[model samples]
Target: MDIRKATIHDIAEKLKITASTVSRALNDNPRISDATKKKVQKVAKQLNYQPNHIASALRSGKSRLIGVVVPTANRNFFSSVIRGIEEIANSLDYKVIISQSYDDYDKEVQTVEALLNARVDGIIASVGKTTENVDHFKKILRKGIPLVLFDRVTNELDVSQVVIDDYYGGFQATEHLINEGCRRIVHFSNSQNINIYKERKRGYEDALIKHGIPVDPNLIVFSKLQLEDGRESMQQILDSKIPFDAVFSSSDYSIMGAMQVLKEKGFKLPEDVKLVGFGDEPFTSFTEPTLTSVNQKSIPMGNFTAETFFEILNHKDQSNNIPRKTILKPELIIRDSSINKEKPKDQTNLEVIEK
Candidate 1:
């Protein structure tokens, strides 16, 4: 037997009907009788005739694929979210094509355009730090594709969004520091433009205000989320006369960097400087002193995104009249790094000097 692409002509020849009738039967038009449709469908299946959806979508304007745009793919947080999205998408028989923005605006714009050219059915994205003007995303929306924003977002656009409450996480971390007797606390953040950082900064400020601590203008330092950036920021902070007893870094990698510098400078953890970080990446728990940080529920966020996109595709999204924002809470994991609680003395003394 020879394998060949099956077509509507095969169905017409088999059914002894005109090709037009076979086509209408295959489409299940009301004008076509049920018997004809059933017969045509059986023959089409046996012939393994697959319709070219691309051609159909060109005429009908729809696709079965979803596009995902994210910041650096190397990070644990984004990768975790992507895993969630991938799992759900795979289960639902949908394809998810992903691209990274690298936290750059122009790169983000280009990625969106390329995804559009691929004619994806919908998109889920976390805008980059430089994505202040969301007009590029807005253009994709104009083409009638549903856009969902996750993690970092732009307030200028009225699109569905899913993100963790970053401000609350910041507030929780900072307040924990003050409660533990840290007077001069500093915020070492990476990007200031994105919502995640902005909200976290606001929370940090609010915590300082509520706790009666004066917000030091010079304390909030900016640095890239890199080991070198962390080390350099620490050096600059140490060089200054302004002393900091505690640090709240927005990224775990930065927290580790600060820790390295603090260790080299001979500062004891929790005693000299209590530290906490955001985005509980894998290394957070294994580091020396075991970093205390915020768990952003990365995987759940991605899965929720995938699940939400499918709903939108199925026309079952929660709301249409008003754009809905699903904000998940970040859990604060208090580890040994920020542990100010004194450990109990070993009861070996009760042995009474055993021989």
Candidate 2:
């Protein structure tokens, strides 16, 4: 004997009820009684009935799915943010589809297009490092899809965004180094075209000026802020014969590379030269001389981004409800890399030597 697949019609026939009644019960429609829903659910389990979500989505005009795009999924920051997004999305019975841009502009465009093709209810993204043209994002808006950006955002697009106070993080990092007796500080920066990097650079310069330290153009280096770039920047500083006592990198990976070079050169951390980095990566606390860095509140930022998406979705039909931008504060985590072993009574008067 051959067995037939179970369907709503079969369950309804078994219970001597209408197929529409079984469908509503299975969908947990409030109009259906609790006893009816339970009976229908029990029959569905016994018959191994599976609801076709795709068909239901098409009928309801709501996929109940969200798309998320990030620069790189491997990074702790992005991963943490993704987790927060999932936490909120799952609570609302929504599923998430994630994609990585790999910091490539073309790849970002392709990813966004793919998500749009998937007919997701909304999209959350962090702009890629090389993303300059945002026409692709605008296309999503034109199609009536809700969009939200976090971290690496662009002001040109009038969309909801969540970001940390990168400027303050930079200022605090530099000021910590100054207080630790580091003068002639070297700064490893990412592309200035990115807003976060630009703000960090500004903060670093302002902190120096506030402390009456001359800003040296030679000490500032711009790169993609990769580990290799960090190594290369350090090498350039060493070869230039520029006397430097500290280094502040916009990325933890880059600063890790700089630390590798400093260690190989037999320089004692926070003694020969102090150091600090952004992102507060997990490894920062595990190194021989633990690193000092900035914590960008990545998980919270992610939660806020997802929540913003929901808000947009709720008000999508209301033209008067304007999108809002959310800004989070960053924290400076001091460690062996930037702390003075012997605390000075008054660090303010420490003399700094510059070349």
Best by lDDT: 2
lDDT against the true structure, each candidate: 0.82, 0.88
Model 2: colliding residue pairs? none
lDDT of 1 by residue, 87-187 (tens): 99989777788899998889999999998887888889998877778889989778767788889888888877888888888998998888778878889
Clash pairs for candidate 1 = none
Across 144-258, the per-residue lDDT of candidate 2 in tens digits comes to: 8898999999998888888888888899889888877777999999889899999999999999999999999999999988899999999999999999999999999999999
Q: What TM-score, over all chains together, does every model reach? A: 0.80, 0.88
* Regions more than 4 Å wrong, model 1: 1-53, 59-61, 316-321, 341-355
> In candidate 2, how many Å is residue 314 off?
1.0
Clash counts per candidate, in order, are 0, 0
